[model samples]
Target chain A: MKTDSEIIITLSDVWKSFGTQTVLKGINLSVIDGKTTIIVGPSGQGKSLILKHILGLIKPDRGQVLFEGKDINAIQKKELNEIRTKIGVLFQNAALFDSMTVFDNVALPLREKTVASESEVREVVDEKLSLMDLRGSNDKYPAQLSGGMKKRVGLARALVLNPRIVFFDEPTTGLDVALSNEIYRFFFKTQEKLKYTAVIVSHDVPKIFKLADYVALISDGVIQDCLSPEDFQMSSNPIIKNFVEATMGTIYSSEAMEV
Target chain B: MLNFVEKLGAYVLYYVNEAGRMGIFLFFSLLNIIKPPYNKIASVLKQIYVIGSLSVFVIIFTGAFTGMVLGLQGYNTLTKFGAEGLLGSAVALSLIRELGPVLSALMVTGRAGSAICAEIGIMRISEQIDALECMAIDPYKFIMAPKFIAGIISMPLLTALFDVIGIFGGYAVGVGLLGGNAGAFFSSMQSDVEFIDVYMGFVKSVCFGLLIVWLCAAKGYYVHLERKGGFGAEGVSNVTTSAVVLTSVSILVMDYFITSMLI
Candidate 1:
């Protein structure tokens, strides 16, 4: 329904290899502003690698990663850090700082990057924690939190700065179906409210499809195709068809047995 | 012969590359320290407490024992020449010149250095470091700079404490136990030990502190690039072991060079 689609991040012919193994041969993708673009793939297909490239955590061997038309890899450290401030990342394991309390973890970026006062930091931290329904859990460390709670806290920290672009790497990876749905609902409400450009790499498959404006299938070190969710399911490309059918079949068959 | 030469060449290249990488890491760590937005006083104080205060008991225990052994041995040896009154000078000169700094450094390398490596290695493996990067905060400034400051400040103070405690231990063994002339012990030590000897100890402690932190932190920070067991809990343990061993060896080696230069 939103018509003003503008591209925010562009990965052009990116290639990467680690030691003897080639992880991404050549990856080209565009992330549109204010939209949820979900990347789904089999394991080791370079889905997370792409997100890292966009975040400047990894550099490509062959091509450029353009953020708002500036090559992130080509920029200086200060500029790159400046660019990173506009971004948020939710790692698969939640990756909260173990030494810090939940409040500190959520308030870190604001304190480090902004000129916010202590009172301002407290107010913002409280607001973000409340947003995640973690109002009373600010003092708990990551080791004390459950998986679902950690995930929610990770989201809270990610959105604390109100970053323009949020990257979720397997956000619902270890959660049960009910928890996954609950997380998705949070995703929906936050995205609707904050309007952040979301680039999520997930394995939740069909359930993840509901949150995506566009779905990209990564396979064999390249994106096979990127299409709308409805068209992705109906994609005639054999790779996309096989992936969609296999995942859907697995989920549906498992559900039927339970029923 | 060709295979042996090939292996030799590989070993040489690997060590050269690693040394260069370590040098670069130290350079950047130093550079980050001098850059703006310095670490908070509280963070540095916490590291000082962890690296300095926590190691006090061990340093005292070891220093006392080392000096007592020196006193017992020196008293017996000097008695041969009827020079047993020089016990205090012998103990003070040896401790202030060499043993105080070197032994204290080795202790810290075992206690604080290994723990620092393990902690940073765990953080590296867990992606907490990566998360810091994603948040646009410099890990060097946030995590490492405080430690470097603490190490530099703590080492000299710890070395001083070790020397003082060791001198007392020697006095107790020589004058109290052996019934040596207490006035002669104090006078000989005062006359023989110069400021330069104390200066040498201070210099060595500072260098040893920097070396311990630099090597241990680098080893842990780059745990992902470790050659063996670089992906899990195994990786952390392997790197921590290497860090402690490497730092210990380097401390002894550095002590020799510094002594040769300054002495």
Candidate 2:
């Protein structure tokens, strides 16, 4: 077994396709423990696809996805589930079950997977909700919450498991400035407190650069570069420079439209 | 014209392949049902609400009206033979043995079954189901099992409710409107109908319920990965409508075999 400080997730020359159109041409990257790796790219550059591959939601057509050096694609379904339990995901739309109350939504993963008593599940859920300052909203349904509140509840649900790895897919996509800042602060605090490795897929260049230790810039079905966020900023690559500069004008640009 | 024909042929071939994949998905779900990791109470409860409780009104309204119309028509035919008293037996027997369950299953398929397909389809499109898969929760256990069980349990119960309410509706039309004796109507129904008649309807309903849930969920789940073209809202809508229409047609087709066996 690798040490705790070693890379937890490694993707080697992974390829994915939808029909003849290749999305991830060949993605190679490693995510180390206790560090946040942000994947920034033009929209539809397969950033979300990479996140899905790590989660084992989709298997690569070629190459390997290694979690702690074991090939995820070759593992049995039950064992793969065991691997998945260690990772938490925050969807772009928050994706909370609209039919359920907030407490039940946050408690879903624990209640579904484990034999935890309702009281125990509630205790854990309440703790996470309180951490996100979402205490009183437990009785509310997802439809009742504003966009920021939904994201907070989504984060609380992701944290309820205390997963070893967490993925945030555009966590601040539609939030107001103040709420977005709050979400960013929550990310930093949660990472520091839990020391969990995070993979964030975002076009929010400033926030990602500020918060991520390692950043991978993908363009045209290939990872253009993967470097320390500081190093990425200092590089003269026109693709990276255009992306970083474009982030300042608008959160999304017309050029980044998925082909 | 050749290009158009080629595209049409390719589209039909694509759908045929999708149906094959959906068959494989159901086979796996059936396998999961017999194996371990059987905890699916939450999903079952959700399905009970979505498939059972939400479907009651439409079933009842349709059942009542279909019974009344059968009474009206059966009364007209029986009157020519001076067999007006056979109206209760005719309506109850047809409703309990065939129309009640079949009609209720059809209506519920249109209402709840379509919704289930659309909901799961949207989830697939949004990557929410994938999120669940990554969490190590078996999508079959977390999503499919509860719905399967709920469909099996609820469809028969709903049909039974339809049978009862439908008989009452026939009674209202025959005795209250057509001036037939209430006592005679009840006696005729009691004399003609057996527990086996009820049993046949319930059996058919259970099978149809399983088909609806399995086909709808399978279509939604498999359609996403199998989509050869670009994935979008159009793909979801196409699958959802096809699921509803296909399940409805299958219910009718299967109803024939079920009725023949029981007869």
Candidate 3:
């Protein structure tokens, strides 16, 4: 378990309900700084909801989301935006602008936020695109790219600002196994080189467990347990064990479980 | 019967809520319409080209036909009383005050408004707007304001073009085809049409512009939050239909009220 000093985000008794359907109730989570924390859970288990609250994209009906020691919900819009600049989000569909080329989509943040010259913006965009191994695809619009290429371009745009932390929403959901493995490897390599804190909400368990420093299991509007993947595999907690067993099959190799 | 009333009540409440939201959106858009540090100048000009310039051919086509019909109908009606000289004033007033602003606005609503709604709706569904918010960018100022400013600036100019072309179309039919005296046709229009009439037409066009853009933009922006299963293609279609229908109805309603007050 991470100590208090290392924690960068804390959700204190957060509850959110959409209409009469209660999605989250009394959810508490601690995300440590400079660590890859993977939120693993069943579909529709409020895993994505927790991510949005931490980013202040949505507010909880009750309780607080504290990011870097400040209550994000209570902060002013300007202050929230300043804090958001430190974070980047890779949406599930890549969300690349259909009208823009890959180069322009990646350059958008710099152009909008900073007064960087066109040449300067181009240099940064090129560096980030190359980092994502999307060099020659710059002139292509999103429609021309395959799913994996779109994800890479999306990752390139998210990292264009060199954010302090990055969030991924199901980075490997739709891709085939080989592409998924490649994405996982890319994420592993980039996060190592960039040293950005990572918070990923994904369902691809055995593979994702390989990248987790801390694995949190949330189910039924509450945190079931949070542990290192090895500990999660051995946990007696029924929800945690059930989630792992369901993903890895009952005859799982424990060697594949190590983080 | 009870279930039907319940559904009816829900529908009314839904429209009422939508109207309140649109009014507030227009209010904020107006407040920020001309505020500087206008970072989205390219976006604004793009919309101007789409909503204003690209629309010229359609406007010319609609204007000519409507004016031709007015000339033929007005000449026939006036000649019954041996007052065919009034055909010029009739055609001019009808084109400038009624068809110019109203038909142009309706055409724009069908052309540009549905496109705007669909585009923004797609942006919403695709999480592009959320991505903007995540990047510390204000989606409203970046997306909504530019379109509003462009539409407002575009409408009056298009209405003026519509009026000019429509009057020429009337001239072609009334004098050339029907053999009305050209001097009387041109002279009566100049004598009878006042400046206030043209000003009122311009005013209607401007108001109609604000209404169409506001309705289309607000419909698209709120599409994701719309509670009536506003998801996928069906949701966007609902928004587009509502935007186009409401724009036409509101333009006619406001035209009557504005003309009544002016007269």
Candidate 4:
């Protein structure tokens, strides 16, 4: 439904290489506002690298990453940081501060980027934590939490700022099937409610397609195609077909392909 | 011979590049400190507790033992020349001018500096630093500047504590156990130990504090870039060990330069 919406982020002919290994070669993609864009690719195929580029964590070897019609890479540091406050990122492994408690971890961005009073911070943190089903775990350190709990906390932290956009880098990499399903459910509910633009790099294959408005298949360091989940499942392109079959073939029940 | 020369050149270039990188890192870290929206006071206070208060027990223990040895040795040496009354002056001057700062720095390096390195190195490897950057939180301002401030604040105080405890330690041994005159001990120390001696120790402690924190924090911050820093837990461990060793060596080397200039 949002396919007709305006584009919020555009990556134009981005080229990035590390030493002798070229990771992203002349890749281009666009993210529509208030839509979930899921990026799927084989590991080490620079799937996560694309997220880093959009976030300005790493510079492309060449080309531009535009956010709301402005070139993020060419902007001033203060402006870039200001742009960053409007976007949230959930990295793989959660990346929670080991020294801070779960509550402080979630409250970090609000505390750092906003002038919210402690009571306001507590109110927001509590609401987010409750949504993440992390109530009563405020005093727990990241080391004390389970893999599923850490991911939920990470998601809570990412959402605390009510960012206009969010990027998830393999949010459920280590969770069990039930836990992964729970996280995906949380993702779906949050994305549905918040209506924020989302760019997720995931390995969950067919299951991930359920939450995607657009699915971009990346192979050989370039996006093969950006299609709706339904069209992606039915595409005849060999690369996309093989990728789909290779990932979905393992769990290929007739019903599982309908996402 | 040709291969040896090539390897030697490579080593020299690597060290030079590393030194340059560290200088730039320090420059940027200082810039972050002076920039607006300064680091929170609570963060600095927490660092003060970790770096200063936590190291108190070891500093006191080491300072006491060092002064006791100085008292026992100084008394023995001066008595040979019928100058036993000068033992208090010798112990007090040696402690206030040199041992207090250098030894205390080494102790804190072992206790707090290594932990700081390991903590930051772990955060680096774990992507916490990158996460902070993603959240628009300046990693240097949030994580590093506070530690630097804490180090500068704590080092002089710790060195002063070391000197005071050392002086009393010397008294406990010289007057109580060695049967030396208690009044002669205090009087000689008061007469011979001038303000310059105290000033020298303060300067050395402050300098050593900065060196310890700067080198340790930089080493950990750049662990990913180190040629042998590897990745994962092994990388953190290797970088932390190197940071402690390097900081200790740098403290000693900087001590000599400061002393040579002041003395």
Point to the candidate with the largest DockQ: 3
Best-to-worst order by lDDT is: 1, 4, 3, 2
The residue ranges of model 2 lying beyond 4 angstroms of the native Cα positions read: A1-5, A236-238, A241-259, B1-9, B40-46, B181-184, B222-239
- Residues A41-150, candidate 2, lDDT per residue (tens digit)? 98888998998788777889998999988899898877887888888889999878777799988998998778899999989998999889887998999889999999
lDDT of 1 by residue, A200-258 (tens): 99988888998989999999999888889977887778888789879897554444345
The CA lDDT at A210 in model 2 is: 89
Question: Whose DockQ is higher: candidate 1's or candidate 2's?
Answer: 1
lDDT of 3 by residue, A1-259 (tens): 5788999899999999987899998889998899989999999999989988998888999999998889998999889999988998898888888888999999999998889999999999999889888889889999999999999988988888988999998998799998888788789878888889999999998889999998998899998887888788888787777777789887653543452
B189-241: candidate 2 lDDT, tens digit per residue? 99999999989998999999999998888878866654443257887788888
Off by over 4 Å in 3: A252-259, B1-13
lDDT of 4 at A34: 84
Could you tell me how far off, in angstroms, the CA of residue B157 lies in candidate 3 after the best superposition?
A: 1.2
Q: Which residue pairs overlap in candidate 3's backbone? A: none
TM-score of chain B of 3: 0.94
Worst 10 residues of 1 chain B by lDDT: B222-231
For model 3 chain A, give the 10-residue run with minimal summed lDDT. Answer: A250-259
DockQ of 2: 0.56
Q: What is the lDDT for A11 in model 4?
A: 91
Worst 10 residues of 2 chain B by lDDT: B222-231
What C-alpha lDDT do the candidate models reach, one value each? 0.90, 0.84, 0.88, 0.89
Q: What docking grade applies to model 2?
A: medium
Q: Taking the tens digit of each residue's C-alpha lDDT, what string does model 1 give over B1-263?
A: 99999889977887787788888888878888889887889999999999999999999999999889888999989999999989999999999999999999999999999989998998998889989999999998988888898999999999998998999899899888999889999999999999999999999999999998999998999898876548799999999999999999999999999999999
lDDT of 3: 0.88
